[model samples]
Target: MKHYLLAVQIDETVPEPEDELREQLARTAKVSDEIKAAGAWVFAGGLLPSHASTVVRPGNGTTTMTDGPFAETKEQLGGFWVIQCEDLDEALAWADRCALACARPIEVRPFDDVV
Candidate 1:
């Protein structure tokens, strides 16, 4: 099996009520548990708002840190899951479940491994 990253994209332009946020969190947690039970879960975590992100750029043998995400977009990566899957189809299947559970768009990418 190879590793895949299932990234959850969320729109940050709109704000969610506290109650709705709690409900989605609960639903996502349930999906995480299901993924673990299926032995496909490596790890999963949610991120803070994109504004909390720091971008580091190395130049002239020095690094500068910039606040916010690298790109200006309405949607940002809100969370991600690392799972081991046989192929893209399996990864997409997991992404489908995650998208439904989290009510967000999921981007599936395979990890590079040379052996």
Candidate 2:
């Protein structure tokens, strides 16, 4: 089995209403349960707003810490699921369900294996 990251992207400019957010969370939980039952769920979690993020960069001989994400974009990574699947096709199928449950775009990326 290969590990893949199913990332949920959110448009931070728009805010989800309280009721909608609750519903989305419930749906997401249901999906998570389904994944776990299938034995593919490694781990998953949601994230705080991008404004709360800090970036650490390495310089010549020291490191610089800055507020915010590495890039300035309307969309940011809101959550992610690390899952083990047979191949990209399986990962993409899982991403589709996750996108529906969270009402956001899901990006599927395979993790690099140690040589």
Candidate 3:
């Protein structure tokens, strides 16, 4: 089996309506439960807003710090799930469910097979 990351993306600044956000959260919970029951769930979590981010770069034996995300892309990684699966197809299936539940895009990537 291999581990895959099901990455969820969302806008960093737009505020979602309360009711819609509630529905999305509920749907995500349902999907999480289903994944757990199937024995495919390894771990899952949401992320804080990008404003909470900090960056550090080392130069000339000194470190410089910067606030905010590493890059200025339109979409930010809002959350993710790490799951052990047989192959990419299985991981992708799970990612599909996640995207629907979260009402956002999902990016599926398999970890390097070193096992």
Give me the candidate number with maximum TM-score. Answer: 2
For candidate 1, give the lDDT of residue 72: 99
Q: Of models 1 and 2, which has the larger TM-score?
A: 2
lDDT of 1 by residue, 1-115 (tens): 9999999999999898899889888989998999899999899889999999999999999999999998999889999999998889999998998888888999999999975
Q: Which 10-residue window in model 3 sums to the lowest lDDT?
A: 106-115
Candidate numbers sorted by TM-score from highest down: 2, 1, 3
- Per-residue alpha-carbon lDDT of candidate 3 for residues 23-110, written as tens digits (9 for 90 to 100): 9999999999999999999999999988889989899999999999999988999999999998889999999999999999999999
**Per-candidate TM-score against the hidden true structure:** 0.94, 0.97, 0.93
lDDT of every predicted structure (CA atoms): 0.93, 0.96, 0.93
lDDT of 2 at 74: 85
In angstroms, how far off is 112's CA in candidate 3?
2.1
- Model 2, 18-104: lDDT tens digits are 999999999999999999999999999999999999999999999999999999998899999999999999999999999999999
Runs in model 2 deviating more than 4 A are none
Return the lDDT, model 2, position 18.
97
Ranked candidates, highest lDDT first:
2, 3, 1
User: How many times do residue backbones clash in model 1?
Assistant: 0
Instruction: Give the number of colliding residue pairs in candidate 2.
Output: 0
The worst-scoring run of ten residues by lDDT in candidate 2 lies at: 106-115
Q: Which prediction has more favorable lDDT, 1 or 2?
A: 2
